[model samples]
Target chain A: MLERALNGGKLYWTWIGFLLAVFGVGFLFYLQQWNVGLGITGMSRDVSWGFYISQFTFLVGIAASGVMVVLPFYLHDYKAFGRITILGEFLAIPAVIMCVTFIVVDLGQPYRAMNVIFHPSPSSILFYDTIVLNGYLLLNLLVGWTCLHAEKKSIAPPKWVKPFIILSIIWAPSIHTVTAFIYAGIPGKHFWLTAVMAARFLASAFASGPALLLILALIVRKFSKFDPGSEAIQTLGKIVTYCMILNVFLLGLELFTAFYSGIPGHMHAWEYLYAGIDGKGVLVPLMWLSAILAAVSISMLVFPQVRKNETLLAIACVCVFFSLWIDKGFGLVVGGFVPNSFEQVTEYWPTLAEFSIAMGVWALGFLILTVLYKVAVSIKEESGGEAIH
Target chain B: MKIERREFLKLAGLSAIFGLGGTAIAASVQQTPSYIPDPKELTGKRWALVINMDKFKTDADVKRVIEVCHTKHNVPNIPNPKQEVKWIFTEMMENVFPEQQDKYLTEHYKHMPFLTLCNHCANPPCVRVCPTQATFKRKSDGIVMMDMHRCIGCRFCMAGCPYGARSLNWIDPRPYLDPKKINPEFPTRMKGVVEKCTLCYELIAVGKIPACAEASNGAIVFGDLEDPKSEVRKVLAETYTIRRKPELGTRPSVYYVIGGMKDAGKGA
Candidate 1:
């Protein structure tokens, strides 16, 4: 079955072909970034972090998506995720790869990324983050591959595997939470300074990330016989609902504190991000659109009729993921920069070179995800494992 | 039920050991700490600013400070204001009397320009939030200084600061200093890092006055708060003065003695 799938043109090459073309185009873009440096991106000194950091931020959520399945399978012993759990773990591999890529490209000296290690400063949250993110990546690859290999041989996983899965379950939240600490730990940027910022980051990540997986699960079901089933998608859907609710609620708390305080230093960030401050603002339209879409998607999740429908669920998932991506990734970072210490606004636009490098990194992730899913689907089909439904 | 007391004790000890062993393998997880400025630095002469808004008036005064410092420090350019990275910027705000802020400032009068720069606070948020210790406070004199090479251009310090004193080099700004001229006193920064006033650290080190003080006609005073006889202490003692954002508790060292703003009273 594995040999047949690998040889079958209709089975997988189409995806491989399409992904390659996109990846090729994105690679060309990255070349321009390599030649010119970050100056090519739409970023300015005022908005030092632009799209690349946003991509890094958004992809961390996607990488953390593996936890949504891991937690249920290990914690609750929900075998429903067994058939598709590998997909989540494999998705994380490329996503983590992309997260690292984005960070490297975003740095002033991409070569010095190793300096983050050679000169480790525990006081720097970024220093600790490098350890957690890479460690989580290795853990996922080992556990997911080891389990899948055992399944191919028709044997139970090693006893050691149990502890690893249990650990990864807790480790998943740690990834997003540490990513949150990256923002929350900043002292004066009032928008990011909130204590709930980490909770909010996880809440939103779990919501949007699982929502994306549900969409992927549905697309797989439609295009291939490897459909994981309605039961799994719906279970994931419920996770999205609970998370999106908490996520949106946290955003509300932020706004409440921002306006209520009346501190210019605090209120100004909100104004610059959503409303434009002192006549210079960039994120207004993108932020507003994301907010509206997120609200609509939340309402759709709440209504059972809409949530249960596969088509509506997929649409809602994609919308919610994009909405949260813009909010968490682009807006959160850029918002921190505006109405700078002097009450002056500076403009930062990502140059084409910057945008291209970002695109290339994401393409690399998609390419890896496509190949991993194909292998998982082939194994599941051959083994006749219980359908996820 | 009373079969073995020794066995019971052994069982208890074994459970405790296993519990500790199990938890040891678990990942060490710690939530990020809440940001509270250390008072240890502030406790000993937490130097602060008190601004006198009355003295600064006229373009000449502003120019005098700019030039005196510009010549002294080789502060590169005067031609293009956009290319200029200011050590100090002057501005004026109408006095908000009955409200005393430890770091607050009155506006720069055409007759009086309120100078603004790094406040060198006891609780420097910029220092605490810097991911890299590129920006730090001096141990001996309590001045905040920046190292350009180490700056990753993350700009978190710029965002963390309440005062808009930090500036980013949006472009390669060095050529404005006249391609031929170079000053070793203040190293020009590469693009993408932040730069700010160092309170003329080199000047103070060399026993020279801060540029702003040298430029002014006795308008600016520089001295040690630790020494009551220092010129600054005498001025701070004789005149009622104000500090910006007294409520935030930054403990700024710059003092202001705005004439009528004493009715404005940051003096207390």
Candidate 2:
């Protein structure tokens, strides 16, 4: 399978080279971050977690999205997903990898990462997050690889794989839920003090994950002999549409609870994010853009005609992906720290070093994704279409 | 390949149970005590602080306390307000207790700065959320303490703390120090760890009071809350006082006596 990854078209090699170049630049910036410590970033005593932790939070949702396909296929026997379950699992691998990298890059002392493992605090949500994330990563690797290996051999997957696949179905939700707990469980952080956090996280994840997968499937169709099949793409679009709707509804509930309750603590972060608090409105425009895009994307996706049209569907998926990214990746983590415990608004915007390091991590994820997708697609082509029954 | 189908299923089932069960057992074994202590067990020392608002006659009084604490503890005097590391400092009443702010009395309370520091809460959120147990409350004295060497510098404790007491050394603080004026008695902290006021735990161990309390001219009272006869206990008994964010239920040890404006001519 790895050998298949070594063989790719000129476009594939060029893409890899481009990502590597970006990664190289980002790695240099990381070295500087290491030397200077976290001072190089925009984070302060007030806004401690900046871009890195947010990205990690967002990517955990993406990784957990694999369950959307897993549940529909394995539990409900949705045959259309059989063509693309490998894609979801492969996407998760890189997403989880990127999640771990973001945490590493964000650390003030990367060398002390092992301390979490050696001294596990069960009371801390972070300990559970680390456990579920690592477990999910291993489960994906085992299940995806073993099943793909069986497909290559033209045989039923080993009897052992079924159990792990079932376990993975249950495990996926735990990763994002625990990640949400990292924020929601905090005492004084009012922005994240909601019961629906895990549910909202899962909704956005289910939407964004499949949305990204649909876009990737279109790319696969354009560039290769393999067709991920119209049925597969259409089914995924439907999944994205429903999840995006749920995500929007959940967000509305959060807004209503904050505004209607009129609790200053609950409304403070929303006011800061949506409208500037005390005249500092760095994220206001972006949040509005996210809301507008969400509405447009959901409207576009709901119509069967637009979803049937490949180009329109692709456009809708892209909008959904970016909308959720802005919501979860940008505002969610940073906004929680606003009105720091003393009720002072200390804004955070990423510095060049921080952005570059983040870009480098993103590039690394894409590179891993590209290699895995290449191998999976090559296997499908070799097997004369979709890998297995 | 020759193994029976039933045997394979049995083997798979057993392995799955053990595989998952083993991790659960290991995590349980490695677990530390919950950050929340048994209230009944907290029988010995219950250190508390009482800041008399009436005695703060001038800004220099608060400034002097901050200077001594920062100078002794090697807290970096980062010029940037955003990146500053403050262990103990004064904050205005409106900012410190927003809920207690009165629009009609705003002008009168303009200069009222509450001496704020780590609450050393009975149930400290920072200690609960620390994955490495780097920040833990001392069982002996109920002082919330941080182990810099063990800290992973995750800043989870910073988020967990409601008092805004914990500060992360974002960079190596050594460069910011005046080497000629560096305090040799206490160690300077390195970058990438959370730290806060230990209620001057080291000085307390040596039968000495905290520098800020000593320098406060009887304004800051430090004594065991459990000992009813102690100065802090007596101050609380005699005066109407308030704690920061008591609604959050952190049970802060620090108390503030907001004496009436009519008593402005007299000091505590």
Candidate 3:
């Protein structure tokens, strides 16, 4: 099946080459970061975490969203998702890989990363996060590979694979939850201190993850023989609509708590992100763009006529993906650090080196994703278009 | 030398097991001796500091305290405020105690500089959040200590701290140090490690106080919080003192004595 990926047309090879080139350039920047230290990035003593960690946070949500498809298909016995469940799992593999890579790149001492394992502190949420993330990655690879292999053989998946599938389903949510706990349980970071953080993370993840899966499903439909079923795509759009609404509602709740309570500590972070504190508003415009996109996406997605229209659905998915990308990937992490512990504002903007390194990690993820999806789609195509499942 | 394949395999497996077991036994037997406290070493149940702001009347007074501690600790003198590293520094009173400030507050209090450093909290969030116990609170005395050698430099401790106390060496700090002024006794830090004031634990081990306290004339008091007779306890009791973000429940060991004028005339 992997050999099918190796035997792609000119366009497929060109795409692979492009991703490799981007990855190679990013790796060069990463090597420089290793030598010069984290100071090469725009992070300061005040805003310690920047683009890399934020990307890690957002990608974890994407990885966890695999469970959205897995649960409905396996537990509820929804036959519509039967063709797309493997796509969800394959997406997870690369998202988790990117999450782990972002973490490694964000570390000041990448060489000492093993210290997290050698001297594990159970009290640390990060320790649990590391365990759950790696565990989720392994689970996805095992389940996705085994199931795809069974499909290739035109047989029911082994009895042994059932328990592993169920475990993977349960393990998926834990990864994003632990990632949220990384910020939520911190002592003085008021923005992340809210109880709704994990919920907000899950909501945005469910919305953005399926939105991406929908876009990919459409691309697969256009490029290959596999359709992923019109019913499955429509159902995914519905899922995205409901989750995006919930995500926006949760943000509204946070805003209410911050403003209504009139606590300076509670309000300051939101003010810094949305309105700016003392005229330092680097994130203000980006946050508003995220808000407007979310509004537009939700409005378009809620209408059944628009969702049924393939072209509108694709546009909505793109809007949801980038909107959440800006919100969770950019605003959330940076917002928590601004008006830094001293009640003094210190804005952060990633340097070109940080952006290049980050772009490299994303390209590496997409490259892996391309290879995995190629194999999965080829197997589906070989089995005479969805009959094997 | 002429053993069969199966026999050779059995011998190799047995030797590997014995080799591992022997190494384990040797390691257990060669364990490092337990630390012995020197007779002259300063011992405390819980170490604490009291910064008497009234005594810090002049700018030079605060500067000297920061200089002495940073010089002793090999803290970098990076020109960029964002990347700068320091063991101790000063902040305006309003910024130091934002919750306590109001428009009508006296100009004397508003403009005053309060010395700041690691609180070495009783409930250190940095220690709790550290994936590796690279930063930990010492059991002998409640001083938060950082093991630079063990830190993976994840910077979780920086986010965990509410005081903005910790700093990561963003670049190799060696270039920032003045070779002529470098203290040969103190180890210089490498890039990609988080460091902060350890309350001069090295000095304390040899029966001396923290560098900041030693240089502050009478403004900074260092002593055991558990000792009722200690200078820190006396100052804290006689004056109205506050810790940074006390509501967060970290129980910071460093206290600021606000509005106390008993030693206001003192100069470094």
Candidate 4:
């Protein structure tokens, strides 16, 4: 199973090379940041978090999305997902890694990150986030590897792995919830002070996670003789459609509450995000674009004919995934900081260096995803294209 | 192995016991002290600061208070307004007390500047949200405290603070600091940590009043709010003073004495 990743086509090798090169450039920027401090980033005292934290928030959702596959396959006994559950779980491993990396890079003292464990404050949501994230990472790695190894050996997975898989199912949603709590629990940050934050996070994650998975599964099916099966892909598309609809509906609910109440605290953040506050609409275009893409994607997903066509399905998945990415990755975190505590408009935009470092982290995630997917695919291909079940 | 349910349960139970035992041992081995002094001991004192705006005569007098605080605290004098480190500074009355601003107020009252700093809230969200005990409210004095050495600089504390009180050292502050002008006894801060007004804890510890209060020429009053006979208590009892964002329920220890003015903006 390990040796399988060693073999790849010229295109595969080239993709890996491109990712590594991006990683190298990003690493250099990280080194510069480490040397001069976070001053190199566009973050200020007003907007203490910018690109890094937003990415962290988005990736946590991606990490939690693995549960969509695991829950259906294990709980409902959905047979279609058997071939790709390992892929979803493996995807979580790197996604969680990216979440942790983003947090470390955002920290002013990255070296002191161990202090979360060294001196834990249980009251802090970040403390819970650390515990659940690391625990989820381990759970996925153990369950994924055990199942894959068992498949390669042409035997049923050990009975012990069953309990852990169930645990993973329950633990997956907790990661995103805990991450949401990090924002939602803050008092003065009106943008994140909603009770529905965790629900919204989970809904978007369920949609975006499987949508990304569908894209990758399509790529795998196209290039390799092994097919993850149309049934699994279509089932995942249904999950994405339902979750994304819920996500957009929740966004509308947030808008209604903010505007209906007309509370300055609640409405100011929305104003700054959508229409701009004090004549500064830096994120207005991005937010509108996300909303439009979300609407179009949902419409495509809802129609049976559009969803049935694999190409249309792929495009819909891309739209949902990218739309949610903009909503979470750019709008949520930065919008929460603008009209800061003083009700002053201090806009934040990522510098080239900052964006490059982000790219580096993404490339790193892809590099890990490539290796892990290759291994999983090879094991499945060797085991006659399906798990023993 | 095809284990039965009973056998699997037994194995899980054994692992659980060992796991619990391992955690207990590890916890005992790393028995670190609590980050702040016990709240039980804090009942002896609850520090408060009250500023009487009526006593304030000139803008230079306010500047003197700010200057003394910065000099005493050895706060870096970064020339850039965007990156300056402020422990205590003056803010326009309209900006600082937005809710209290009045349209009918005289020009003198309209443009007047008031001193501002951390409220040092009785119930501080910053202390509550800090991952490490880097930001803690002192139980004894009720003053919000920061231990920069322990701060991981995640800025959660900054987010948690409602008043925009905290500032992160975005760059190494030493390069911008004037060594000759800085207090020799007060230590400068390193980059990559959140810092703010500590209410001159060092001065308080030495039985001297805060630098800002000492320089305010009896305008800024400092005493124990819990003490019924203290000057701060007396000022609050006799004067019509207000705290910033009191509706938020942070119970800020700082109070302002506004002279016979009404919030005309609020249909006065």
lDDT by residue (A172-257, candidate 2, tens digit) is: 99999999999998888989989999999999999999999999989988888878899989999999999999999999999999
Candidate 3: where is the Cα deviation over 4 Å? Answer: A385-389, B1-34, B263-268
Per-residue CA lDDT of model 1 for B124-176, tens digit only, reads 87777666677888887788888777776555566666666676654455654
Deviation of model 1 at A158, angstroms? 1.7
Q: For candidate 4, write residues B182-212 as lDDT tens digits.
A: 7888888888899999988877765678888
Which rank order by TM-score, best down to worst? Answer: 3, 2, 4, 1
* Candidate 4 Cα outliers beyond 4 Å, as residue runs: B1-44, B80-82, B100-110, B260-268
- Mind listing the fnat for each candidate? 0.22, 0.82, 0.88, 0.66
Query: Model 3 over residues A1-389: C-alpha lDDT tens digits?
Result: 67778978999999999999999999999999999999999999999999999999999999999998888988888888989999999999999999999999998888899999989999999999999999999999999999899989988888898898899989988898899999999988999998999999999999999999999999999999988999999999999999999999999999899899998889998888889988899999999999899999999999999999999999999999999999999999999998887688888999999999999999999999999999999989877545223
Fnat for candidate 2 (0 to 1): 0.82
Candidate 1 shows a clash count of 52
Q: Pick the candidate with the highest DockQ.
A: 3
lDDT of 4: 0.87
Question: Per-candidate TM vs. native?
Answer: 0.81, 0.92, 0.95, 0.91
- In candidate 4, the residue pairs with backbone N, CA or C atoms under 3 Å apart (3 or more residues apart, or in different chains) clash, namely B42-B140
Residue pairs of candidate 3 with colliding backbone atoms: none
Q: Give the TM-score of candidate 3.
A: 0.95
Cα-based RMSD of the predictions, in order? 12.0, 9.0, 4.8, 8.4
